[model samples]
Target: MNALLVITALLAATPITLEETRTQGRKNTQALQAELDVTVAREDQRSARSNLLPQVQLSAGPNLSYQGRRRQVVTIPVTETEVLTREVVSSANTSDSYGASLGLSQVIYNRGLWKQLEQAGVNVDAVRNQSIEEADTSELEAIRRFFTLFLSQATLDVLQATAKRSEEQLERARALFHAGRVGKTEEISAEVNLGNDRINVVQRQSQLVADQVQLAVWLARPGTEALQAVDPGILQQEPAPAPALDDALKQAREHRALLRALQQRVRVAELQRAIVRGDYLPRVGLQAQYAHGNQDLGPFFSEPGFGNTFNGGVTLTWDLFNGFNTDAQSARAQANIRRAELTFAQTARELEAEVRRAHQALDGQIASAKLATTNRAAATQGLMLAEERFRAGAGSTLEVRDAQLKLTQAELVLLQSRIDVEIARYALYRATGTLNPGDSQ
Candidate 1:
């Protein structure tokens, strides 16, 4: 067990990838809450369905009673020729009784009840779709957090490299000054550059720590520990082509879980209106019951003669007038239906806009990544030439520093542009509602 615990801890400390982040996110609190909502909706549907089925009930109890007689009427024949009557007090006694009853009831026809069942079924569908939407959203958010942490790490890496290079330049300048070959100005310039570079590195490190905490929170892990992301290495490859705007919009309409859930809601609202209308109609049902009981004048639980009863009947009920309650309910249901329809329409428009925006962003990022790639190449060449010239005594300290700074900026830009391309692609996938976290596409 101790060895197992060590291994688990080691695994937990390992850097996480995009796929792992999304997998853990599926078990996050929001996703779990959405799943519970679906369970509750399913149970509601079952309850509604039960209204149409037969219901059986059984009841049993022991009954105890005591009565004191106040008065009684007695009649007797007196001497075979006359009759006498008198009023007199009676005795008190206790009686014990046991009784049991079984009953069954079934709805023959209740339009409103049937409509409610249908509405409940639609509600289940809506809740299920909403759960899917929530899960998808969680996965997308995980992807975002993963990329943000990766960007922070990449930026820090670039800054540290620049700082290291600046330190070397400073050492070179100090050596020249000690040998009386370069003036104090050159040494001072190099010192100031290194100091600034070190400061930037410190700032980047602080940002990195904050990014780690954010990623850990999204993963539902302890924020006290730091988190790292494994590079997806998308930077090594050429940017993939972005899809056409119209195609993305089409996919969004077809596959978005939110849209499907809203459509289900509209159906539910319509069914609710139907149920309200059904309240105006009469209802029919069937009922049956059987009872058995025994009473004794002696002690409790004593044997006594028993009696049985059975009853069965068909029942019909109609509301001649209800204080406009049904009318009010009908109006509310109609309003709900209209609201559902309008919400769906509004969402559709917003979704289209989202898809278009994501597509445009992907296109722009791809172009920027390509341009940054070229610029980085140029900066590298410029840095090499400047170092060669400085060693050959043909370049000033300021020129070398300028080249170094440009190269550093170029590298950072390229890194950011590449990462942005990936982020933009992910946004497009999310907008199209087709982003499966671990999928290669």
Candidate 2:
């Protein structure tokens, strides 16, 4: 830290080298790419679990009880017949009971090509694709922020250089005033101008720092090293040819993750309809229950203890008659299928439009970036001339200052144009779903 401070003092407004900042941004983007991959893998696992066999549960419990019974007796009448027989009968008793059991069941059949399972698989793909898209978007944002800070830092560097030149000119003006060749006002004006330039440099440096911090946060960096910025226009690639609108649209339709997810959802919707419609079909499955229990006896019934029970059978169920509800359900299923088909068609059209618009925008932006670069070159030359003319006393300080401002503005414009190109590139990547961490490297 002390070394950096010493260097800053010595350099006093000179542009610092920026090699570390770009590396940090790249690292952060790579991490996000890996994170997205994990997300996709988890979604795949979740889908597999959903497709697995249904789980069975077992339960057991005990019971207790008591009961009462009645008795009946018969006798002969006194006056009627000489001799008659009498009889007596007793009722049954009741008691407590306990039991334990196991049971099993499973899905036997369905129509529509195992639609439920297919739907689950599609959902997994959709979520994974969306994750990739989100990651790409995040990476793009990080790249932009890093570049923004870099450019801001560059601007500060230029301002610092210009401020130093003004300080030198201020010294010269003071010397000229002492020699009675220039007025005191010119000397004071130089000092005042230098102070303003210093302030400008400081403000821009603050902006650059804030931008770097934001970039670091997005990258999930672990520690703080005062991140330096990168030089702009260092072996920048030649602008690539823009694809035709139709071609771009076709590529996007085949690629964009959001579009693909929507396509998957349409399949899922169709599958859901098939699942409900399949309810009308007869289903076959095996079921088995094994139990052990004791029951109490009551009145006419006798008590039994520790009895073993076993049952196994195949079952078939058909909703043959359901107040015509199944017919309505089938119709609804058909309607949902139609709706999904329409949605798919609509999505395709929308995707085409988005791709076409992005292509058009990128073409225009690339041209704009080139023009801005040309302007910056010319302005730089103009500033050089102004500085030389002022040194020889052929031009006023105002001329030098004006040229300096022009050069800075030109630099800013070029920077903005470059940013526009990158943003357009991000747009293209979003449309095509072709953004890879590889692209950053």
RMSD of 1: 4.9
Angstrom error of the Cα, residue 76, model 1: value is: 6.2
Model 2: per-residue Cα lDDT over 42-91, one tens digit each: 67656655444554558766576555565556667767666565666666
RMSD of each: 4.9, 6.8
Q: Candidate 1, TM-score vs. the true structure?
A: 0.90
At residue 417, what lDDT does model 1 achieve? Answer: 91
Candidate 2: TM-score?
0.75
Candidate 1 structure quality by residue, lDDT tens digits, 1-441: 322432353356558888898788776779889999999999998999999999999998889999997798998889788989999899998888778789999999999999999989889888988887788778778788888888887887787788778888888888878887778898899999988987887787678678878878877888877777888888679999999888899888888878989999999999999998887999999999998777743422354334778999999999878999999999999999999999999999999999999999999999999999999999989988987786666776798899999999999999889888988898898888787633211
Q: What is the lDDT of residue 304 in candidate 2?
A: 32
lDDT of each: 0.84, 0.67
Candidate 2 collision pairs: 65-96, 92-299, 93-297
Model 2: residues with Cα > 4 Å off, grouped in runs: 1-55, 66-98, 220-247, 294-306, 330-343, 437-441
